[model samples]
Target: MRFAKQKRHRKTIKRFCACFGFREPFKVLCDGTFVHHLVANHLADTTVSNTLGAPVQLFTTRCVIEELKSLGSSHAKSFRASCRDYKLARCDHEEKESALNCIIKIIGDNNPDHFFVATQDIDLREKCRKIPGVPVLYGLRNALFLEKLSKFQDEYLKAAEDERSRMTDSEFKLLHKRLKNTHGLKDLSTAKNGSDDEDLLLQSPVNRPLRKMDTKDTVQFKRKKAKGPNPLSCKKKKSTSNSGPNVRKTDETGNDAKRSRSRKRKRTHTAKTSNDGATN
Candidate 1:
């Protein structure tokens, strides 16, 4: 295959694998038309696996083999022989049904089995596009192509991804569990007449357990109270000595000595007497 075509096919396979949970050893379900195309084109059936670039297990339902058998063409023998090597997927049809109907029933609304549909039937291809997680493969001449996701498939993938993004795995599990319990409660309410189990589940707070608050959990603010005056702003008191009496006495004696020194002597009389004695 050309590099561009291979790359495109690879990308389409990857998108299907990522979005639809396709795993290794892909299971491809083939119908009679596709098998006939392979035989008519003289292509090796392994060409499909090779183009896919992955280990593949081809599958066909009993109805497809029956349909090919009914054709009665010599090419139809080759188609049946081509399908002979494929693994049979049980349609379990007690009566014969069309190959398209068999494939559709197997795929259902969503392909939980992760089937890659190989077909040349336009109707089947159109139907596969509408169902999410079904990747269709078709061949032109010698080249095989994996079809890109249809609009419906893309929209389904986007919606599923959006839902998954909005909810985590744990949330999904919890939601499932809650639903189970709700259903159980509803059943119990119906069995016991006049029981309010469902009503309580919907409206009462008792449905959910209350968390107990610890004493330490209570928020306590530090209250503002009256405090002593600021020590920095107060006047300093004089530090008194232990000998208070002796200090007072010493202060009084110092005051007396100062008064005696400050008193005036009889200097005037003494100076006049000395002058008269010298003159006589």
Candidate 2:
């Protein structure tokens, strides 16, 4: 059961990373409420990293730290001791404001810095949900979990996907070129010499009249030409005698000499031996 829950949390983190370009060592902005929860529950700061299954950098704004200081000595000491290593985020307020307001103002509508908000405040979490590209994290008892994508975030993802599926920049440029050629419109960059071309360039592209495109303007494929036989696959032709009848006769004679008509008998010295035996 725990494994399944961990898998689901990791999947949610992956979605945020894919959509909002979250990088390694994720930045988690900790609020005063979240710090208080950690201190009260005796939870180690590593719980955030363990929950997300990634390296994480904890950050707290000056306002949040100021709010933590007002919670009394015991809470302040323990919280500061535990999170002493956390990086302080600059909130840029001359006087300290409420932690909620400070965080909301920094995040704005889009969460451009790609921060994962770690907070126990219900209001803060709800506000984060409405903004696109902000992943929220909260704790239940000892277990920490990343929140699922809200409706706004999901819609933003869908819109981005749709935009990607449309034509690319190169394709749009090619289309513009084809349209200009089909309408016989001179390119605006080269229209400096002609008064009419300059006037036409002043008008919007949509205001131009649509006419039937010429056949020449359409793309034409090259016709395939006849090809010669493959030299490697062809048999070599016989060479003919070019000199005259003498060269032909010589060639014929050479052919006749090369041809074997019949088998020849081996010469024997048996007659000489028989005469010598008779004489002996």
Candidate 3:
């Protein structure tokens, strides 16, 4: 009985391991929202647990855990309970700082085999792309794509069902009209029909003005003048006079001599007074 139970347990573990591609175990670095979502919906938790299987670790930052806790008591309780079954790791200040530093260092590191960074933040994505080997996986892009696929699937299924349903002639006409007037479908169909007339109209000279391309010389004419002195230089003649030749001068040398004589007399008187005072 013990041997049979052991064999069954081994088989279960093997199956669980196989489900995750039998590669290096995935460490899910998720935000608090993911935890709350899993806990709020039992089916979601089951799906995630099944997909990840055993050996998958849950890594979250303290900030994320706090966010999950803030969701409500029930969500916090449920999340806490779910976390007990897995390898749960919390990112401390040091760890977060380390992660940020790693991101900064890896940018331009050019290691081809380096692990890619995953982030939803546009700023972070931009920062990561600056590094050579670090590729950023934008979560919003994947989310948007998944949402579009889901919407498409729903629309397709509804259309299929509508086609199958037995309807009155009026209802069928309305359905056909709705499908014909669908937002992108009409444009897509128009494109698929190879009708180049609309395209030609769009491209026609009447619709789109023919922009005259400027020659290199014409472009140079429009450019701002260079800051430096022109290579074809002109010499500026030096003016010998204090004032320009156009200006009238009053008593040019006489006023200068009178001022100099006055200054010399004033200096001689001051010196005589000082000498007399010194003698006294």
Candidate 4:
């Protein structure tokens, strides 16, 4: 079955290429799950070839690559099969704190221009917002919307069945009873309420007083004396000596006087030297 699916996907790709002009390659950030679904949809012939025109370029971190590999042989094969000619790009393996950060750095460094990131992760969305030109799409939402549309079609079929049968009141009641039994509505509702009550009870704190430990009875105990001089007093004293009155005293008197006297001596020596040179 899987082989057949793969063959069909290849045919679709060929047809798509024949129909639409080859799309300009766009850097696309995709994780394993996104690629898996893309493969499945393409094989099913439900995926719009028009939408698939953009050449997808996959970007991931080393961590995500390892995660994808850990999904076992079949999944790894499907993931690779889905991504034909898609260049795998990875960010700095050590600099990244998370997969999303790695993805962001890759996009920032490689394509500062706008590109598409296909992900359902909220954290990824938040991180991508900081990048100047990257756009992110929630891949899960697209898959889920398609699933819901399929379910709606099934419901439409069921309604049509009900109308055609024109089921009697007793027959309808029997069907409703079977549905309720199969769904376990009454038991599930009761269990759900019980769980909610348990959660509420856990959230409410008990008003019990904390038990005091008898320090006098313990051998390891030492009575704490009153806190005396600040432990930081030595630092304070050193800072004051370096910065306060002592620094000002050196600047105001000692250094200034020495500099003035040195200047006077230099001027006197220069005058004598010039006089001696003129006489010579």
Candidate 5:
């Protein structure tokens, strides 16, 4: 804890020369331990004090909520009540990350909202300090002390002035000369001595786009055309229902079907009579 405090002080001095904490509302992240500490001291009213450059807003992660629930019934209830004042941020790695690890990951990520870890844990504080631009906040005697950090990309900054001064007078030539034989320049005449307007019209029947021929589709269509009619398909079966004086007109096929069913019965075996009797 002492080491974390000393290191925080040193970094805060460096921050004076570095990042300006112009964050409209500096977001302070609280862990389970921080939440418990805040609740125990009845410090919810003072959690968002104006000691920092901008107004402060308290926030906690889902992992912190899980951690609070694991603490027990009473503490969980208190944490739940305290949470109404702070926004709960959904944690991406709930199963894999601890509260401290999750917090470190959230703040250490590139171009994240400026956050200050409001906790009393020495290990967590020390861990957060290693990341580029994170601040540590601790409560002392009902007041909060914020340890600010400012880290910049020294090498990534472009040396524009030096580049401007390095350009010599001898290298004044422009790149990429215009070519006379290029497509747009060479084609000045729109008149051509070839096909007529009708041939060029894509909408004409002769110029219609050809369909992509597929053997499978053509073969399937031919097979479907050649297939026998389904016997189960409903045929307009005409029954000989007498409709009061006017019989419904029947087609030739129906007549033919009736004729086939009423074919003359074959003679019941010609009497092998007289010959049979003599033979017997």
Candidate 6:
């Protein structure tokens, strides 16, 4: 039994493409096997798929091309011929890192619009499917199929959709533009006539703004501010009246003490007179 078959129609990729809605073209990155499959798809006249947004644009990296060339296989030569028309994506490739790493980096750095990966390599498919927002296309059972989704697929899709909605909305764009202007870029406005700006300067009929008025500038309006019972003033008056009563009570107590002392002095004189008489 043939393990896989490439169909002419785009029925396979439709399911994956439907999940994402893009205003810009959906970029589809390809490796060697992807190109090999594309040849089959091309023969079937299904090179272009029915897309909801901008159609998919196939891109490859220089390393991918180099890898295919080094394969020295008949299929590799055929894959190269099919991919000759497609442009090599300007991707960052370090000698230390593998081609897969470079591809992942590009996928990460490119944002707003998510890119899809097409490959028959099990490793690539598994790696990309694990990442959020990346859809993987592969061949199985004689036909192309999207990556086998697991339970986490729904969660990833939901997250991707939320991110997509956030990024596409006006608020994020305004904030991003503001940040750009604040940091590196300058705010740009179209040229306007000087007279036009002047026309908007004065909102009222007066040529100048209403002049500020101080005491010397104009007669102050003396309208009695609607007087409610001032609680603070009432409290102050109540406190003062309470203190007055206490002060009067203190003065009366002092006078009483003086009278008592006089009476005591009179009693002491009477006692001394009685004692003197007894002695005589």
Best by lDDT: 1
Question: Model 6, 195: alpha-carbon shift in Å?
Answer: 58
Decoy 1 TM-score against native: 0.59
- Model 3, range 1-280, lDDT digits (tens) per residue? 5455445544533532342123334344444444444544443433433433334444444444555556687676645854564333433245434334433443335423233343344555555554433323323211210011123334544554454443445544554466456434555346554354344333432343223344853545456866987655856766776555445445855553222222344344443464565652
Per-candidate local distance difference test: 0.78, 0.78, 0.42, 0.48, 0.59, 0.56
Write candidate 6's Cα lDDT for 26-125 as tens digits. 6777777777665655532144343222366777787777777766875665455646656667775556345576677777732334667777787877
lDDT for model 2 comes to 0.78
**Residue 156 of model 1: what lDDT?**
88
Query: For every model shown, what is its TM-score relative to the native structure?
Result: 0.59, 0.62, 0.26, 0.33, 0.46, 0.44
In angstroms, give how far residue 99 of model 2 lies from its true place: 0.7
- Candidate 1 clashes: the total is 0
Clashes of each: 0, 0, 3, 0, 0, 2
State which candidate has the highest TM-score. 2
Query: Which has the higher TM-score value, candidate number 5 or candidate number 6?
Result: 5
Evaluate residue 41 in candidate 2 and report its C-alpha lDDT on the 0 to 100 scale.
85
* Per-residue C-alpha lDDT of model 2 across residues 153-236, encoded as one tens digit per residue: 899899777656555556455656765676566665554444564454444544433444568988899999999999877977
Q: lDDT (0-100) at residue 12 of candidate 3?
A: 37
Model 3 deviation from the true structure expressed as Cα RMSD, one decimal place: 24.2
Candidate 5 lDDT score at position 65: 76
Model 6 stretches astray by more than 4 angstroms: 1-21, 40-45, 48-54, 109-113, 148-150, 157-280
List candidate 5 stretches off by more than 4 Å: 1-22, 94-96, 109-111, 148-280
Q: What is the C-alpha RMSD of each candidate to the true structure, in Å?
A: 18.0, 11.5, 24.2, 26.6, 24.5, 23.2
Worst 10 residues of 5 by lDDT: 171-180
Q: What RMSD value applies to candidate 4?
A: 26.6
Worst 10 residues of 3 by lDDT: 141-150
Q: By TM-score, how accurate is candidate 4?
A: 0.33
